[model samples]
Target: MDLELYQVDAFADTVFSGNPAAVIPLYEWLSDDLMQNIAMENNLSETAFFVRKGEYFELRWFTPESEVDLCGHATLASAHVLYEHLDYDDPVVVFETKSGRLFVDRENGFYSMDFPAWPFHEIQVTERVAAALGARPDKLYMGHRDMMAVFENEAQVRELKPDFRLVAKVDGLCIICTAPGLDYDFVSRFFTPDVSIPEDPVTGSAHCMLVPYWAKRLGKSQLTAFQASARGGVLKCEDLGDRVKLSGQAVTYMKGMIVL
Candidate 1:
């Protein structure tokens, strides 16, 4: 059989800049092993698969190694596929995911994603954490899905060269390093060597944790953020009571058939 596959650069207006995700538009759910294998074969940070369900859709995300609870870039890429490739005419598309209901809307030329915020709390920085990061952060925190390390400035966030082997031993699925940005309100970098992603170019999910922290610290509900990965990308962030809004642009990089 042949499956439709699309590679999209999420949170980027142009190709090859933002996070790249593989999107498979499925009419029916495929087996877990099959999807996982496909994701592994695709070898992107995340591969998103969606099956249409009435006006909304059911979405799942997989890395090369395992399935994740939530993923921001792949979700944006999926929405991009639905709107741009599948001829979806709606301005807003809702998705049922492992994390719960998610909504993506088209506003102007950008795609705005509404995601559930992961509440995080400050944690004591340990020797192991400091060793893994190479540079010790000023503060450390843990969220529902990731551990955050706050640095003094953007230079600290950008200059990081983490020990991936040691970072994999950390308690969380991923580590988020962030600091105040010069161009944007805040800047961040995400590392998930445990799950095979050394660094994510643009992470929307990490911003769920970043947005709340920065909003409370900066005393603002709306903010701008940049992910300082090798292939950097921009994100517009907003903090709501129990949710966060992350807006960015996506473009299709490639489309082809996957034979199985």
Candidate 2:
């Protein structure tokens, strides 16, 4: 079997800046082991697979190690493939996913993803948490896949060096450290040793938790977010009651076929 594949850099207007995800549009669902092997071969942060389901697409995301419930950038990348490469003429694309229904809208030069808002609950700052991040956090919280630590400022967020092995044992998907940004509303970094990604360049799902927290704290509906990894990315964020709107640009990097 030969499968069509596209590699896209999501949340970036340019070719090489954002998080790279491999997209495979399959006619039917492949086995879990096959998908894992494909993701491992691609060696990207996430690999997205989709099969058409009536009017919606059934989407699933896999890392090198495991499959995840939700993934932001990869979903954006998949939408890019559908709209640009697959020649999907629709302005709106709907995905039926493990997390539920996800929608993406195409505009002039950007794609906006409507994702579920993940509310965070406050947590105590423990020594293990502090030791993993190599810094003390003023506030700590937990989301579905990560532990969020709010630092004093953006500079602190940028300067953090995390112990990935320790963080992997923290009983979550990853660790997110964030602070107020100078150019945007907030800046963040995502680290997940459990998923084979040491630091994620741009994370869309992380902002789901962030948009709600900052929207309530800053009392604003629309905001800008920056992921402060070495290869950085910018995202436009909006709060929509139960969901968040994440808008960003994607660039197609490569195209190929996988032979099995």
How does residue 206 of candidate 2 score in lDDT? Answer: 93
Estimated TM-score per prediction? 0.99, 0.98
Clashes of 1: 0
Per-residue lDDT of candidate 1, residues 126-224 (tens digit): 999999999999999999779999999999889898999999999899999999999999999999999999998999999889999999999999999
TM-score for candidate 2, residues paired by index: 0.98
- What lDDT score goes with residue 59 in model 2? 97
| Model 2 alpha-carbon drift over 4 Å, by segment | none
Local distance difference test scores for all models: 0.94, 0.93
lDDT of 2 at 136: 90
Please give, for residues 98-196, the per-residue lDDT of candidate 2 as tens digits.
999999999988999999998779999999999999999999999766789999899999999999888888857888899989999999999888889
**Residue 151 displacement (Å), model 1:** 0.4
Model 2, position 224: C-alpha lDDT score: 96
lDDT accuracy of residue 105 in candidate 2: 93
